[model samples]
Target: MRNFWGLMRAYWFSSSWKEAWTLTVVIALLTALSSKAGVWFAEASGELINSIAFFHDAANTTPLTSLLENAAFLVGLVVIKDAGITGSRTYISATLHRRWRAWLDNRFNEALLDANHSHFHAQHGAGTPAPDNIDQRVQESIKDMTGGAIGLAMGVMAVATSLYFVGQKLISSSTEVAGLEFLGSYGSAVLAFVAVAVYVPLNTWIAVKLGGMLEQLSIRMQRAEGSYRGELTTLLRRSFHVAASRGEDVQKAMHERLYVDIDQTWGRHNIVSASYASFERVYNFVGARIVAYGPGLIPFVHNRIDLKGYITGAELVNALISQCSWFIHVMPAIATLRANSKRVIEVAVAIENVQKPDEFYRRTGRSEFRRTSQNPVFGLTIQNLELAHEGHDTTPFLAIDQLRFRRGEWIFLRGESGCGKTSLLKAINGLWPYGRGTIVLPEGVKSFYAAQDVRLPQVSLKEQVCLPDAPKDHSDARVAAALHKAGLGEFIEHLGDVTRQGKGWDQQLSGGQKQKLVVARILLQQPGLLFLDEASAALDPEGKIAFHQAIKDNCPNATVVSIMHEATPPRSASGTEFYDSVVTIADGTVIKKPLQPPLPAEITEILNRPAMRQPTRSPAMEEGWRRIARLRLKQK
Candidate 1:
């Protein structure tokens, strides 16, 4: 219940509260008006039937003009009531749905995309597995929540209106019966209340149990479906390796497990659905009959009315049944609303939990960055940092007592796989918070990180290079020159074409080409601090040298910290001797050493046999080299 109210307050008390409340009130008014129209129409129907009966019984005295007028009025009332319901339902529902969806999407994005919040999600697990299908949660869950809320609200209003108007009528028309003076006029309302009092407790118990079961089943089924889809997508991504290794049998077994999971979950859901449906049918049948028969039974038992009055009593019974039927209709809607509300609140709680750590930091007045002094010579300073994975109390992954990199120092970080090279980098960037650390970085320093796998947006090539900002921020000439230096000059012609619509960079470019594009991004942005984690591992040896040389030439003053599998010592006379330090991490410790210049023999061999040392280059590559030379000369 607490969680449910929290979810409600999240939206109802959001920034759009005024608009949301206005729409809600308008919808309620429309619902009330429609309910009143329904009651008026029912009364008109009863009066029309009674008048017809009167005219038939006394043909000489009855007026035909009065019958025609009643008929016309009934037809007009039906049309107007239906039109109001349709218009109000359509407009109010659409507006409220749009508003709720927009607000939820914004809040979820703000939470999930925060730097600390993102790290938390990446490190820790939500109590129940976090929702894998965020798009579905944002789109489908919000749709269900908003639509079900409106439906439940309108249903409650219908019941309230029916009871108020119908109960008043029943109580107003009174009569004495059999000298006991029993309250005959209030019989229907009293019977309806008694029936509800008897039925609601049992029905509510069953509905609550079944609704909880169904909600759990639904969550499991959705998770299974998402897993199956993810498996298929992974298969497509690794099709080549799977086919090469003849992994068809293994993949088939994995797919079968996913299918079995979905099947069992759905089977359980169907059982609960069947049980609830049967119970609903029985409850409605028994409750409606009890309310319908109560009005006629009273007068018949007491002998209070003649044959004509008994027939009139039957008409009144039918009228009461017609008005009170909303009780029966709203039962299933309440159950559905409960289940959907649970699903929505589960997602909301997950997002809130992930963001709590960041909230704590903000409340304690702790900023993400810790700066020692203004404009420090060192771009990064790490002191007594110990890093570990979340939920683990074992030895730390990488521990550094003291480390600092001055501005314009080109440093190569090398470590074996799973030796905490990448983890250390993440800790330095304030992305890993599972351990004790104080990292003091220069304030207002611009930084860029390129991971092993580059993820470009589905936008034009020009825009992708200038990502997280507009392409117009950089001059066309500078963008083209950077591309040329990064060996992507050939793609300059197709820069305007969107990298989507089946023409994504992953499909259109080779692995080496993609890495070059990442390099192009670095060259274009020219941040003061750059961290490259296996950024050039996909390229050939010559290509790697060329990109490193380009980075050195273009951004000489930037601090470069690169993580690689093996350290590549620079040649002596190639102007690639800028690397100042080499840091190697192993056994949860770091060792830093100054870079040594290449041996005299290595420089002499490279100069004597250039063709034997260097890989063959295509015309585009030659043009790229020439462009790099021109850029270097212009820089000088």
Candidate 2:
């Protein structure tokens, strides 16, 4: 009950909570007033019936006339009151449901961004899906949780109202007789009161158990859907090798488990429904028998007293009506209230998990540096660095003993897949899980990371190249230069206006074009320390060489660290040495190698032409008969 109340209180702090509260208050008033009217009519009818039965010895007339008149009047009033209540309840309930759902979606969207920053990739358990795909939970689980809580609350309220009226009517007529008739009716009312104590707890327990089963079933349903969709793609693509190697029999067996889990959960729900149905049936039966027939039974037992001493048939009917009135008056409201309450709890739990952990890392305010600092010496240094997950101790994902990138240096990290190459890059950029280490990025140092697959938004060609907020005028010229350097000059030239249907960046760009656009974006960014993860793989050999030269031209003093399968040209005598230090990894161990010139055999073959060692023409120049060789020969 305390948890349920807490859930309701949480909604008060949400965006649309004030409107929800106003609607709730309106629903509550209509419910209370309608309920009061029913109770009053029942009490008035009981009084009129008692008068007729008591005056039977003193020229008593027919009691049917009074009973019919009161019944008709009460019935008419109930019709009008219920109409208003129903309309008001529908409008309010619909508003509350929609607003609450919208609030949950907003929270989930916020969690996606927040959790991504906090390194929540593996936060969901192994069998569970990623946290960002929690859309199903937000849409479905929250609805069920809220519905269950509301139903439980409204059920309690209805039961309370029914018992209150029945209890008063029974106690008032308890002294009417000394026979078994009185005992039969009064004893049943006592039993009904005791049953309320016993069955309410039992039903509450059943509901909670059923709710757990439903939540589990919902998760299984999602897993099955994802599996089915994945398998369908594999089947269409004729990727049967994976299935054949695992044995198609095993795949079918795996699917059967999901089906069985959902089946078993639905089976348990039947037991819950049966338990509730049985309790309601018994409560209604006993209340009617005790309130309607118990008082009339006493008239036959005590012959000395008039029908007044006991209760007339009309009074007995009114008492029964009062006892059963809550079924109409209170049940629906309590049900809705319980359902809303549970949804509120689920939202609160998700929000709390994402919002906490403020003590860990908060971005501190500092003035931005305009240029890269050169004060830090040109030597790599690493003090202490360690990587450990929250609950594990033995093994770690990344173990950076001590490492750093010196200013104006080119460092190459080469390693096998999953040998922590990507993880190391993430750690350097502060994207991985937090660890105990102090990374003093020199005062004006800026870092840029290009992941394996470039991420491009579905925007115009210029926007994709320059990012959304970049200046439109500057983007056009810079994008052209970057594309030309990367050998994507023809592609960009054809995609002139990104807004036109066939010419739009998103409409015409391929995977390779998108990769080139990312390089263009970075060229424009010109960060101090550029971390490239196979960034130039989309380009040809000549394009790759030009791309490297363009980086040196754009950010002359910046340090570059790259993960590459191909090596750049070795240190030259006249030209600048592109990469001074090369760190290679073969078996998870870093090997520092000297940047030596080409082998003797290769140099002997290239001695025929001096231009072979150092090309005079620009890399972007096309090959033809009227080349630099022809021009140099004529000058000689």
Largest TM-score belongs to which candidate?
1
Residue-wise C-alpha lDDT for candidate 1, range 438-529, written one tens digit per residue: 78776677788888886655678888777655888987777788899999998887777886456777667777888999888889988888
Model 2: lDDT of residue 363: 21
Q: What's the CA error at residue 159 for candidate 1, in Å?
A: 2.1
Top lDDT prediction, candidate number: 1
The 10-residue segment with the lowest total lDDT in model 2? 362-371
Give Cα distance to truth, residue 73, candidate 2, Å. 5.1
Off by over 4 Å in 2: 1-8, 13-20, 37-79, 119-133, 151-257, 267-382, 386-402, 406-410, 434-436, 442-447, 453-514, 520-529, 535-559, 567-581, 586-636
Candidate 2 lDDT: 0.53
